[model samples]
Target: MIVARELPVHPQASFFGAGPYPARRAAIAAAAVLAGFVLTAIWSAPFVDSVIGDSVANGLLGYDAKATPIGGVLAGTLFAFVSGLAGSFTACNIAAFGAVAPLVGGQAGEKRRFATTLKPLGWIAAGMLTVSVVYGVIVALVGTRMPQFSTAQTTRLSPRSVQSMIAFGVVGLVFLLLGLIALGLLRGPGFLRRHPAAPLVLMGALIGGFLIGRPYPLFRIMFRSAAEQHNVLYGAAAFALQSVGNIVVMAVLFLILTHATGGRVQRWLAAKPARIATVTGAALLVGGTFTLLYWDVRVLGRLGIIWFPMISW
Candidate 1:
């Protein structure tokens, strides 16, 4: 007698599942981002800056931090680290939180708590440092200063304003497009959808790019110091530390969530594809809208081209 046996079949996972879930996610994400844009417009357009940008930097490093001469390599490293820690709260930098959900995985029956928790953070660091190191090297080799430091102004735009416009505008569009893809409204990169770590890497790359057009006083100071050192390695290290500092708080929060919940949060999210889409899509939408409206549209108001509410922090 011959017997035939059938092998087990497994279902493929969707980046963002099909069905009513996509529509629900899109609606929820759009509404949330819209509300955020409204609040930032009426309140703080460059929300992080208005909220804690220069003040945080100045308070932590002192007003003279920019002008003070570096005493040693260690001092400069410390400055870069502290400055990054200070900038963590900025609207621009805060967008890095979008990566948190993507980084955490809900592996079925996973028992290694320490590895599970720290692995995501390490992946994030790898992605972040990859971009930061490259950017630092390129910037160092080319030898340029932060445009934000320039006082020269055109009829309506300054160097700083233009930098903000270009940097945030590009990054915002990318985030917006990513959110759309995550919501299933658009196609995502094949790799990004298939690989677990791809989204985290992309998110980290965006965070590293923050150095391209940042205007924070302490950051500007750090950049100048890095330039003066004229060592590409130093620049790379400083920028690396900066990225590290930017996410320290968020990392702590993620750890707390994982430990406090005993890893239930990610497991719950992983059980359903739509749940991940909801969290990630919402974050990307908010980050994208805030970046665009704050840096570009808000600049128009500063130039007196339109009326945007002005507030004193």
Candidate 2:
């Protein structure tokens, strides 16, 4: 009689036991994102406004620019915490999808297929999240202190204000250019044909530059007319709400993109030989353009070269 021998378990089979069910993981990530949103709203509504008001008043009345810096630091810390929570939520979602892709796509016949996809997604999410949190914190710290740097009277457009606008406009142009370059690079032959990474990188750069530079002019214009506007508090709250809302919107968009791409992502990943050079080069170029725009605007404003147009409601 011939003895029957058990076959060795496949590596792909291990995935079924390695992580939590995909649905559960996705739900947990969603919950974390929601919780973070709630916490951010609470802190931003009253606490942040009060801090800003105090900081502004102290700086203006005592000519103590340091008060603004203190306020900025506090705001930055809060934003950093919120950004961290958002990053965690995003990461968990990416992991869940990665863990489930093989099962969902029915690719379990291939060894280590799921792990292969998940690893890169996990690393990319972690790196992007770290960068976002750091960026958010820096923005918050500097933003709160901005009002203190102005001249005593609000209505008159100071020479410094003009300088700021010119600087900001130049920076915006630079980011726009970089975004265009990224688009061109992505259209070139290579992994760009399959990966969405290039587009994402371009979007991030444009968004970052707009966030940092665009706001300065608008804020300056608003500051001048704030006395006539009774809704300064509301404006502050709206800004905070918008910031958190944008994150939620992006997460939803990512979900949609994932669903839309479906099995194509897996196929592309399996076929490509990890084109790191292409992805990294495109990302760095786009990111650097945004950074340049951000700093240039502030330097220009300080030099009194441009003035932001006031918005009338």
Candidate 3:
């Protein structure tokens, strides 16, 4: 018989010491997912021409190989981050439930109720991730289509369009007001203790309202000019700028919602909101900066602002 000697555990290796390991693991997983997304976006460029050849030839959309190579890349990166974060949050919640389920079930009915509430959140996150990925793939495959632009596009503002914009603006203001009200409700004494989920529910409602009310008619107006100019770089830059704007507006609204709901939202909301904000902000800032740098160079080219070396990277 062979004798086996067990290794002694380190004295410092307590449960508290091990607590941050899961967080570190989650961060690493998120980073890896982000990297994979970027790589996949780069790989999808070759198929763009073949996938949308008919649309391009039919004058429905425009495509330039050299100028817009980065469009798919940017879209892919955004979609990947969104989907990855959603997945990470869902996984973290599921893990939390697994650990707490036994204790909660043994004691008061808190565990069951908590798990029941969490299930829908997880499902919604999953669904959103799926939709984001599908949209990303479609965008990548078809490339972005240029909207038809005419003189009507430039100068014509219809009465119905004006009325619609006014209506949307009014609706958005109402939601904004409601969000503020919810915030006030949250700040009352014992509000956090009594109604933990109220802030999240209110925030979601506000964000949904904003998305529904916002108009992106600019894309339609600029489509023809962008395509006729064969300015893939300009198109990509504009798309990136628009996406950044959307993300910025969403982030500001998110922050406002959280602030209104009290200083801190729920654990689940708190965890991913910071990460999403950080990633989205970083991407937008970097993309916008680069786009502006290039735009300045082009303007200099056109206006004779400065004569310098035409450095192509």
Candidate 4:
């Protein structure tokens, strides 16, 4: 029988702190989640895509991708990819930045900057591709769409509101559980803890799944076009690229961090198991709480279930 060796402790500092203290870690996690909830209730934190998304759309595409005339196969595909890139920082997908914490840290005995940066990203891409392609293909086959495109209300809640809640709720739960496990508050499957790649893949899946509930104007345009086309290959390819575009910025940042430092910073931080836990835990908690609170609390407030400050005003 082989016994697993303990990770070596590194002496350093990071935004998440390199020290190991359960009490402090728990407090930080709680605070981060609380902030997520508050910001979400107020305005879904990062849903303000118009500012950035529109700017990108106009700057590059020469017109607002929102409800603009998208022509030609090439135009449709480019619009899909660009629109996705535009919303990369929206509340719908912002939480994905957390995966950077784990990816920044090199795997045990893996120190090459190139491998360290690309390997986990590859795994994440695989996960994202799986979800996005399947979703797109399903859209092609069923010709169905989210109720967000409609202006109808169902009693206390609009169908679009309910749809948003359901889609984001599921993904939020996944993030919550992952955060708990990372914080050691919950004991998940042994393999999840044993294999670092597992959580990263899961992260990517959740990020890709963001599209399922996205109500952004630009994305809605893309969705409408893709659905109408009824082309399986186009839908799959389009969604796959969209998913890639979603993470392109973060992935680039990760690459720069790893390559710039030649993996030294990553090594120093990832060297300590405790620091890795801290960063990963904080990220998951914030993302989970934000997704759930933004979609549910905000929507429910609009439905009169609960009072939200922003909604009241």
Number of the top-ranking candidate, with TM-score as the measure:
4
- Candidate 1 segments whose C-alpha is farther than 4 A from its true place: 1-23, 42-67, 104-112, 144-149, 267-273, 309-313
TM-score of candidate 2 to 2 decimals: 0.30
When sorted by lDDT, best at the front, the candidate numbers are: 4, 1, 2, 3
Instruction: Give the CA lDDT, 0 to 100, for residue 242 in model 3.
Output: 30
| Runs of candidate 2 exceeding 4 Å displacement | 1-239, 294-313
Cα shift from native, residue 156, model 1 (Å):
2.4
Model 4, 108-160: lDDT tens digits are 22456465447778888988899999998877666645465566777777676
- Where is the poorest 10-residue window by lDDT in model 2? 90-99
Candidate 3 Cα misplacement greater than 4 A, ranges? 1-70, 73-171, 179-199, 208-313
lDDT of 1 by residue, 1-313 (tens): 9997532111112333331244576577778589558745665425465346555656776655656776767887888888898788775676777655544433322444666568667767887899888877765666565465577888778897788789878888888777667666777667664776666667777888777777776777788777777789888988899889899988887776667677687567656646666666676777787777777787698778987765644
lDDT of 1: 0.68
Report the Cα lDDT for candidate 4.
Answer: 0.73
Q: If both were scored by TM-score, which would come out higher, candidate 2 or candidate 3?
A: 2
Local error of candidate 2 at residue 230 (angstroms): 12
